[model samples]
Target: MVFKESFWTLSFDGAAAGGKGGTEIVLTRKSGEKLYLSYKLDFHCSNNEAEYEALIWGLIAAEKHSIKKIQIQGDSKLIVKQVSRQFVLKEPVLATYRTTIQRLLDKFQKFEIEHVPHSDNKFSDAFTTLGVRVDIPEEEVTIVIKKRTEPSIILENKDLPKDLREKILE
Candidate 1:
């Protein structure tokens, strides 16, 4: 969805290993001319399962932020297209995930979905180890959990307008 006055901007990530999916979701909203939100989710499961799980958590996350309109970005093309109705899901497994995601999406006042290539998704990549992060209006904080990898959590205050630098500590 295109930004109008205020909209929620967020990314949902799901990674799979040994047929298990891991998920990380980041939610940001435009509040008082900047981006802020109430919550985020990062967890581990199966890749496909996490994909679906991310969408579920995404809906909850945006809802918690009081977001009426949303624009979601993800690396799963199949998930994007299936949810968008551009392509029909034929896989039995994907069909289930699609259904679950659709239920969460139905709760939104306005919603749009798109796919980003995996390489550009640093949030999900960094959350590969199953940790969660959350930011609320007037709150600067990070979710503390176990680490499974070396990726530093790039926690930023959504109220600030800034360019993202990949893997760099500034």
Candidate 2:
């Protein structure tokens, strides 16, 4: 399958506050077109988890767009190092995230991840911090929710909170 461009550039960032987190991704094509994605995670996650979610979600967006070669840029030094094989992931949760990211990246023909300073990644950082506040043009922004783990079946409908039960009903 011939692609329109030789490569795409993806910049990602994650932000966390009050035990909640958000992720943002910006994808730019060689032709100067751009796509923005942001996700609000319902589950509790650390800053590192947020970073991994950004990386993984960006890769998934690339795959969906039929992009084969890409450059990934992010502000998370630890995530960048682990993905680049420069550092080992000791935490079980992070290890799982790393594995998932690697699996998705394997689908690409060529991919490079680099750690950029936070200043260099201001666009994504702003979106992450804002969560879903600012709305981009409908064609440009994609919003999603990131659930790190599946919901447990152990909880019966009667045991779920009213709001959660209503969501399940939907």
Which prediction has the highest TM-score against the true structure? Answer: 2
The TM-score obtained by model 1 is 0.62
Residue-level lDDT tens digits of model 2 in 51-168: 8877877887888889999999989999999999899878877877787787888999998889999888787788898873443443553445333332222123357787884454
Which residues of candidate 2, in runs, are more than 4 Å off? Answer: 1-4, 132-170
Candidate 1 residue-wise lDDT, 6-112, digit = tens: 66776877565654344577776556333322122223444555565666556665766677888898888877888898998777756656765676677778888
Best by lDDT: 2
Model 1, residue pairs in steric clash: 20-46, 20-47, 21-45, 21-46, 21-47, 35-158
lDDT of 1 at 89: 75
- Model 1: weakest 10-residue lDDT segment is 146-155
In terms of lDDT, the poorest run of 10 residues in model 2 is 148-157
